[model samples]
Structures are given as C-alpha cells and as structure tokens.
Target: MRRAFPWLVLFLLCLGLTPVVFAQSQSELDELRREIAELDEKIDAAEAEKSAVAGDLAVAQEEFYEAAEAVDAAQVKVDAVQAEIDTEEVQLAEIELDLDTFKTALAATEKELTETETRVVDQTAELYMATATQAPLVFEFTDTEEIALSSAYVDDALGNSAELAASLEGLRDQADRERVSLAGAREEQQTLLAALDEKRGRLQTEVDALDEVKQVEAAEMGELQALVDGINANIAAAERHKDGLEADSARIEDELARRAARQREEEQQNDGGGGDGGGAPPPGANGWVRPVPGGVSSGFGYRTHPISGARKLHTGLDMSAGCGEPIYAANGGTVVTASWYGGYGNAIIIDHGGGVATLYAHQTSFAVGSGTSVSAGQVVGYVGTTGYSTGCHLHFEVRLSGTPVDPSPYIP
Candidate 1:
C-alpha cells in the first residue's frame, strides 16, 4: 500500500499537468488565428485605397491631355492670325510705295507747269518792251511790206505766249488734283494698316491668355498625376504586405494545428491508461475589446508599400492613437510573446484559451511580460511609430485557430 501511494501521487501530478499543456497549445493556436485575421483586414483596406487613387489619377491624366490640346489649338490660332497680319502688312507696304510714287509724279508735274509759266511770262515781257521802243519808228518809215512783216511777227509772238500760259494753267490744275487724290489714297491705306494692326494685337492677346490658361491646366493635371502615382504605390505595398501576412499565418496555423492534434492524442492516451483527464476548459467569459480607443487609420488588407512601392498585405488594424497611449488586451489571455519583433516593434501577443488570440504591434513600451495573465481591457502596451510604422498608432490583430481573421467582429 505504501508503494501504491507513491505511484498514486505520480499519477495525480501527471493529471494536473495535462490540462496546463493543452491550454498552452490552444493559446498558441488562437494567437496564430488572430494574426491571420489582422492580415486580411489590412489587405482589404489597401486594395480599396488603391482603387480610389487610380480613379483620381485617370481623371487627372485626362484633364492634362485636354489642357495640352487647348494649348495646341491656341497656338494654331495664333499662327493663323500672324499669317493674316503678315499678309496685311505686305499690302500696306505696297500701298505705301504707290503713294510715294504718286507724290513724286505730282511734284514733277508741278515743276513742269511752273517752268512753262515762267517762260510765258518772259516772252510777254519782251514783246511789251519791243512794242514800246519800236512802234513810233515803224509807223513813220516802214513801207507796206516791212509793216506787214512786223505786224505778223508781233501777232505770232503774242499768240504763242497766250497759248503757253493757258497750257501751263491747265497742267498746274491737273497736277494739284492728282496730288489731292494721292493724299486721299495714302490716308485710306494708313487707316487700313492701323485696323489690321489692331486686329493683330487683339488676336495676340487672346493667344497669350489661352496660353496662360493652358499652362495652369497643365500644372493641375501634373499634380493630379502625382497624386495618382502615390496612390498606386500605396496599393502595391498593401498587396505585398497582405501576401506576406497570409504566408506567415498559413505556416503558423499549420504548426498550431499539428501541435493541437498531438495534444489531443496525448490526452486520449492518458485517458485510456486510466489517468484522470480533466474536461476542456470553459469558454472565455470576457468579450473582445478595442486595443486602442481611436479611429482606424489604416485598415487590414492589401496596399501599396509606401517605401518599397510593392504590393503587400497589411496584416493588422492601425488605430489612430497618439504615441504612448495605452493599448488594452482584447480579451483575457496569457501573454505568449512580449518583445521586439521585426517590423512589429515592441509587439505583444496574447493567447486566450479556445483557439483565440490577439496581437498588439508598434508599441512604445509593454506593460505586461510574456507568460503573464491579462484580463480584457487590461493595458498591455503603449502606442508608437516603431518598426515600419509611418506614425504613432496601435497595430491590433485577432486570430482564431491560428489563422488570422478580421478583428472587426471581435472589436467593440
């Protein structure tokens, strides 16, 4: 009976240890499940954001094209107007040359008229002097033949002078009229040239204004394009992140499943051996709570990576919380991991029993240590912009059966 007592004590200890081992396995599975959920959420968010940005970028590019077209059209009009102005200027130059010719001709005509008048005046003056000096002698001594010849000479001279004066007066009048006509033509030509110049100026102004508008529109389009590019980058990053998370979650889930199966089989063996096998632990009484009391800044899903420009999955919910803000546990659980993790930065993972778990990432500091039990709404860490984070926030995740699932359903 004494030897049987020692064997009984050993059996009791084994029975007591069995539940603890099972619980630990379950916690690990739950944590993996939570991680998967968080990754899925991140991917969804990134995809949506990328889609919106792409649409905007398309519009911007369209607008930019339109602006370019406008600029081209305006340039064409400017060219056409310039051509017209050039033609008008050529006509104006021709008219100006014609005017100069007319003035020169008029001046020559006036000079010829003045010379004829001067010659007529000189002839008349000579005839008058000859008549005064020779009239008495000619009348007293001249025979009939001589008188007839002198009278013929005086008549011929006077008649020639009168004819020359009349011709000169007609030429002068004609030349004056021609000069007036040419002046009128020149004035008309000048007016036409001015009108053409004014038209050209207006056309040029219009072109300038259109060019300015085109420039402004082009700039706006460029800005829109840049925005679109940025969005595309974000989408790609999101997708890559999502893929990574999915792979990680799958691997972890498989490991947890294998561990769980082993735990179950061991329990079955223990039971068959007549060991006291405790029943499954009860379901958690505490419901899920938000890790941070803040709006979701980045949703879990595929998004463009900001730095790498790659499509990646984001595997967690980014809460818009200030740095150093307390992060609470989503449910009562034992801390599975509490340490600096690559990209997660000061992360803490909690394992609630029954294949449920939650993760808190990018924490400035941790309040709880690994293996420590935590209650729902217990402060587990503080928010931070650490390890791949753009700003201060809480990256929260939930898992079920070691597979990541959306935390929204579980978060309040």
Candidate 2:
C-alpha cells in the first residue's frame, strides 16, 4: 500500500505540470500574432509614402520644364533687342559719314562765295579808276573817223562794266541760296543724330531689361534643376526604403509563422500544462517635436528667393533664432550624417527608424556625431547663417521614407 501511494503522488505532480506548459505556449502564439499585425501596418504605411514621393517627383519635373522654357524665351528677347541695337549703330555710323560730307561741301561753297566777292571788289575799283582818269569827251568835233572810234571804245567799256556787276550780283544770290540749303542739311543731320541717339538709348534699355530677365530666368532654372535632383534623390531613397520594409515585413511574417507553429506543437505536447505570461510593449509613437523654439521665418513652399529673386521651392522650415542657439533632435534616432553639406552648411541627418528621418541645417556647431544615438529634445547642433542662409536660423526638415514633407504637422 505505501508503494502505491508513492506512484499516485508522482502521477498528481505530472498532472499539475501539464497546464502550466500549455499556458506558456499560448502566450508565445499571442505575441507572434501581435508582431504580424504590426508588420502589416508598417507595409501599408510604406506603400502610402511611396505614392506621395512619386507625386512630388512629378511636380518637381514639371516645374523644371517650365523654368527651362522661361529661360529660353528670355534669351530670345535679349537677342532680338541686341540685334536692333546693332542695326541702329550701323545706321548711326552711315549718318555720321553723310554729315561729314555735307560739312565739307558747305566749307567749299563758303570759300567760293568769298573769292567771288573779292574779285568783284577788285573789278569795281579798276572801273572807278578808269572813269576818274578819263575825262568826259563830247563827240561834237567834225572829225568823223576819230568820233566813230571814240564812241565805239566808250560803248564797249560800259557794256563790259554792266556785265561784270550783273555777274557779281548773281554770284552773291547763288552763294546765299547755297548757304541756306547747307544750313537746312545740317539741321536735318542734327535731327537725325538726335533721333538715332534716342533710338539707341531705347534699344539699349530694352536689351538691359531683357538681360535682367534672362538672368532671373536662368537662376530659376538652376533652382528648378536642383529641386529636381533633390526629388530624384528622395524618390530613390524612398524606393530603397520601401524595398527594405517589404523585406523586413516578409522576414517578420516568416518568423511569426515559425513561432506560431512551434507554439502549437508545444501546446499539443503539453495539453495538461498551464501558465500565465506577459506581452511586449507596443511599438514606438510616430511623430516629432520642433527642433528649435521660435516662429518660422520661412515656410515650406514656392517663394521668391530673397537674394536671387527667383521663384523656387523652399523645402524646409526656417526657424528664426539667434546665432549659436541650440538645436534639438526632433525624435529618437541614429545620426546617419553629421558634417558639412553643400548649401546646408554644418548639417546633421538622423534616421528615426521605420523610414522616418529628420535634418538640421546651417548650424554653427555640431553636438552630435555620425552613428550616435540621440533622443528627442537632445541638443544636436547650433543655429547659424552658414552656407546659403540669409540669417541665423535653424533649417529643420522631416522626411518620411526620405521624401521631404511639410514639417508643420509634426512639430508640437
């Protein structure tokens, strides 16, 4: 009877262990199911992010095309105005040559008139001398041969004097008319020169304006190109992230399935086992806080560049702050980049897991290093006016799957 009692005690102990083992298996199964559900949610979020990035890329491409076209049109206008200026310059040169010719002709005409006046003065003096030296002779003497000869001599002298005076007078009138005509030609030349000058001025002004327009257009095109490049980079990064997420989800699913199978087998093997277990904590929250405490000096969207005056996309928020002001991390993440970046100055980029990231730009100094872990509100850098910044401020950005999105919603 004592040996039978010992067997019964061992049997009761085995029965007590069975439910504990089965309860442990059930707990494992529930954990796997929760993990699978989280993976499914992550996949859905990744898909939506990809779609958004694609749309932004398309908009950026269209803007680039439009900017290029504007640059082309401005260049054409500049060329046309320049051409008009060149034509006007040529015409001005020809007109100047014609004016020189007119001036030379006028000088010759004045010289001729002066010479004619001098000749007339000399001839009049000679006629006066002849008349003073020769006495008035009356042809009353009865000598017919002498009378006829004297009469013929006097008549010929009178006829010669009258012809000389009349020719001089006609020469004077012709000189006066030539002078008037030359004056009119000079006046016309002056008018033409003034008109040509005005035309040149107008054309030059147009050319200058067009040149300015072209410069602005060119600047806008360059900005657009940069924007397109950024969008392309974002798209590439997003695609890679999507692929990674998908792979991760697949791996997680496989792991969950394996764990579920193991749990089921364990439960079947220990149908009499019983236990209680706890589940893991839920996934981390998805959101961000402001990197700096200040009002936004510049908002995200298209705006005219203050320095370049070109319309361009402002991809991030510019928080106004004093130089050397501390900049905080927006969320918990691993710093992927911490160094000088083109146009961004001393920039820092953090990967916050689940395809989320944040950027801090134009910093005077860095407080964090690459590959270092950081927590929300941790100082990562200082505000500065480095690189292309117009003032001391923090350029904060939030990226979902590497695509820049408006950071306003994420900020508290």
Candidate 3:
C-alpha cells in the first residue's frame, strides 16, 4: 500500500506538470525573448544598412550616368575640334600656297622690269657716247663739207638731232616708270604677305586654343568618369557590406528562434504536454474576455500583403469593423502603448498580468495612452484599417512575454 501511494503521488505530480509545461514562466520566457529581441535589433540594423546602400547605389548610378553623358559630350566636342583644326590647317595651307604664288609672280615681274631697265640704260649710254665722240668730228667735217659743198653733207648736217635726244629721254622715262610700277607691285605683294601671315597666325592661335580646350575637357571628363567609377565601387562595396549585415542578423535570428523552439520542445517533453492543450478553464471567471468584438475578416495564415503586394503569412487575425469603432480592452490591464506603429497606424497595446499581452492595430483614434489603466471591456480605441491593409480592420495579436500564440484558445 505504501508503494501504491508513492505511485499515486508521482502520477499526481506528473499530472500537475501539464499546466506548468503548457505555460512557460515569465523569467525564462523573458530571457528567451530578450535574445530574440537582440536578434531583431541586429536585423533592424542590417535593414538600415541595406537601405543606405540602396541610396548610395542610386546616387552612384545617377552620377555614373551623368558622367557617361558628359564623356560622350566631350568626345563629340573633341571630334568637332579636330575637324575644325583640320579645316583650319587646310585653309592655312591654301593661304600659304596663294601667297607663294603671288610672290613668285611678283618676282617674275620684277625680273622682267630689271632686264628692261638695264637694256634701256645701255641703249641710252651708247647713244650718248656715240653722239659725244661724233659731235666734235661733225663740227670739223661740217666746216670741210661747207668748203667742199657735197650733196651727202646736207643729210649729215643734222647731227645730234632732236628726234634722237627726245627718243633717248623718252626711253629713260619709260624705264623709270616701269621700275616704279614694279617696286610698287612688290611692296603691295609684301603687304599682302604680311596680312596673310597675320591672319594665318590668328587662325593658328585659335586652333591651339581649341586644342587646349579639348585637352581640358577630355581630362575633366576622365576625372568625372573616375569619380563615377569610384562611387559605383563604393556602392557595390556598401551593398555587399549591407548584405553581410543582413545575413548576420538573419543567422542570429535563426539561432535565437532555434534555441527558443528547442527550449519549448524540451519543456513540452519533460512535462508530456506536446500539442494537447485541452484543460479545465480558469475558475471564478464568467469566460475569457473578448479582446475586441468584431467579425473576422482575415484569419491567421498566408495572405497577400496590401502594400507590398507580397505573399506573406498573417501572423495574427484581422478583425473586420467600421472606422472609429470603439475598441475595448481585451483583458484588465494597463496600456503598454497607444501610438502609431509602422504598418499599423494608430496602434494600442495592453499588458495583462503574468506576461500576457494583446495588441490592437489599425485604429482610427485612441481612447487611452501608455500607462493608462483599464478594466476588461473598457473602450480603449477606435478601429480602422490605417496601414498595410485592404479595408477597415483591426489587427489583433496575443503574446506570452514576446512570443506570439494562437489567440482563439484564450479568447473564448
């Protein structure tokens, strides 16, 4: 009988463990939750890094694109400058050729004028010397001829005649005029050469300036391209770094989740409280408090996210209700928070005792704020779809410590 009594006691002890195993203690759950929260922080940091990288990438791409455009524009300018230089060079060459041709023509004309002037000078000298030497003889012959009175002497009477003198003077005058004309033409040609040279020099200077501009533009383009390349590299590096952070965060989160799951499993195994959770309800209470009375618009599971258009599992249930519907306190507790939450605009949180908590999200307005105390069924807020939802609804969640659980069991 003593042995049977011990067996009964052990049996009772094992039975008592069912509820204990069903709910983890606040301290142990909080520790595990703290680890999860730390991992969540890591994930958040990783996401922030990733977002920064994305921004860097966008800026880099924009700069790269602008730089590429500038490079192309500079290249076009370089091409244009090259063409202009070529054209100017050709024009300079043509000008030079023209100057040379004109110079050669002037030289030829000068040569002809010099030869003609020399010929005229020689003719005049011969005529002057002949007349001088013959003048004295003529004077002597004229006296003899007058004494002899010959018929041929009459023709010789007109020695050093006006016609010969006049012709000599006229020839000299023509040579002088030819010399003046040739000299003047040579001076004109020289003036033209000087003008052409000046023009050519200016053109050359312009070409040089264009060349310099091209070099500067090309260099600037190269530098900008390098900057763009560096920025792109930085963006890539930042992206990789951000990805690493995200992966690290994910690993930590996975490890935390795995540890938590293992702990939960171990607790379940030690107390033989696996999936079976049916038990006697808490006594002295009419029933479980309804968190918020509303029709279920969406249940827990996969659903299309309204904003992201992504297929994601709904972590909790969505309650269908009108906008500004008076939201009630799920259970008697203090308000943990009532504020806007990301993707859950105008949210409220209620903390029940023993680490039990409830979240009401997508509220049009709030009736309470953080630190406010309230009883069950007290109006806490108004309900509406404010973020990441298709219609007016309340996103409700039940958690033990920081871990989510099915709300249906506690609701009824």
Report the lDDT of model 3 for residue 43. 40
Task: Estimate, for each residue in 348-382, the C-alpha lDDT of model 2 and write its tens digit.
Answer: 99999899888998776676689988877776766
> CA lDDT of 370 in candidate 2?
100
Ordered from best to worst TM-score, the candidate numbers read 1, 2, 3
Which model, 1 or 2, shows the larger lDDT? Answer: 1
Task: Estimate the TM-score for candidate 2.
Answer: 0.38
Estimate the overall C-alpha local distance difference test score of candidate 1.
0.64
| lDDT of each candidate versus the true structure | 0.64, 0.61, 0.57
How would the candidate models be sorted by lDDT, starting from the highest?
A: 1, 2, 3
Q: Per-residue lDDT of 5-92 in model 1, one digit per residue for the tens?
A: 2232332232231111112232343343334344344445545554665566566567657766876776677677678777777777
Off by over 4 Å in 2: 1-160, 203-207, 272-412
Which lDDT tens digits does candidate 3 get at residues 53-165?
45554554565566556556655655665665566566556656665765676566556656655665565566655655765654466676645533333234334244544
Q: lDDT for model 3, on a 0 to 1 scale?
A: 0.57
Model 3 residue 368 lDDT score:
65
Q: In model 1, which regions exceed 4 Å deviation?
A: 1-87, 136-160, 273-412
